[model samples]
Target: MTTTKPNMHAVAINPATWPRQTYFYYFTKIAPSGFSLTVNMDITATLAWTKAHHVKFNAVYLYLVSRLLTTHPEMRIGYLNDQLVTFDVLHPSYTILHANRTMANLWTTYDTDFETFYQHYLADQAEFSALPGPMPKTPQTPNLVNIGCLPGVHFSSYTPLPFKPLDSFFPIFQAGQFKKDADKTIMPLSITVNHATIDGDHLSRFFNELQSCWEQPTQYLA
Candidate 1:
């Protein structure tokens, strides 16, 4: 509930500067004493929005996480014990096209919230559609690059563990209204943690709570 600027400095590095694979990096601190466990929830939900309004899914996703942040202000994301620490926010990986010469690469960028970034995604789609000829599969991740303001963090498509039941729990899909043909989506959230802060049991409970959240996104939308 307090908002004095932090004298502590946490550097937000450009994704281009980071290795494509995940890493255990220092983000922020949790408690005066290091936390003994960390948990990440991969929440998947069935949205009722279309591809055009797919951005709405992002908006709703962001809204839910932002609300959690506001209510649980203590859950702010930062560095803890030399690991990337995130608050109660649900980070979703968004698929975007990336251009590498004639070959276009499909990749994802993490968005802490959906509203702002989805707007940008839609704008870019419009801008690119106006251009000529055989467009690649889709628009590449755009030339715009910044740190932590809008794009948030970038992530690659993560295939969950092969187990079907457990794999079904992760969230990893594009925004679109659920239809018979629309593939089922799961939000697979991932975080690298320092052993000093969290444990596997805590991770299980985190997934449980996250499941509760996605089961009813509106309940937490307040």
Candidate 2:
């Protein structure tokens, strides 16, 4: 689990000219709101690719979601040091079930290159996967999207209620077990986001692009 911390910085946005400033204010100050949406994403191609490559499906899911989140600037918007800012890149802080039934929180710095990120993910698991505690193996960062998978349960919907205050705007993702729907494999993915930053359009585009990636895993996963 020994790795150098990447040079992370949060760049402030100028509200005067920022297009979403008014929406941000209204959502955060006037009536703070957030929503969650769950969709059954087709993962037939993705599952086959993972099996053929002998790769973990969870890793592929995390990489694809994190990659897509980076593409949408709204998903990366969060407060840093009490100042509104957007991060250069967002990392995936995910849960790893331990042998003793407890879970460990581990994170890997995201990279545009899938192989590099996959190696980092494997290394983190190697070092911390056996730990029986919820404490994070690596230091926590502001630029993170909370991610988890429940491989045993295939549910229709899921909504996450964070114990932390509602001020935090970074998205949270949870993926459920794979379900066979006729000839297609579906995975229920729940995305929880703040309205101050992400809107319905953003979510729609995210899902559309995500489905494309799942449909053509060779293009993105390879």
TM-score of every model versus the real structure: 0.34, 0.95
lDDT of 1: 0.35
Candidate 1 TM-score, true structure as reference: 0.34
Best by lDDT: 2
Clashing pairs in 2: none
| Per-model CA lDDT versus the true structure | 0.35, 0.86
RMSD of each: 13.0, 1.4
**Alpha-carbon shift of residue 190 in model 2 (angstroms):** 0.4
Worst 10 residues of 1 by lDDT: 141-150
> lDDT value for candidate 2?
0.86
lDDT of 1 by residue, 100-148 (tens): 3232222123344444445544554445433444442243322111111
lDDT of 1 at 211: 59
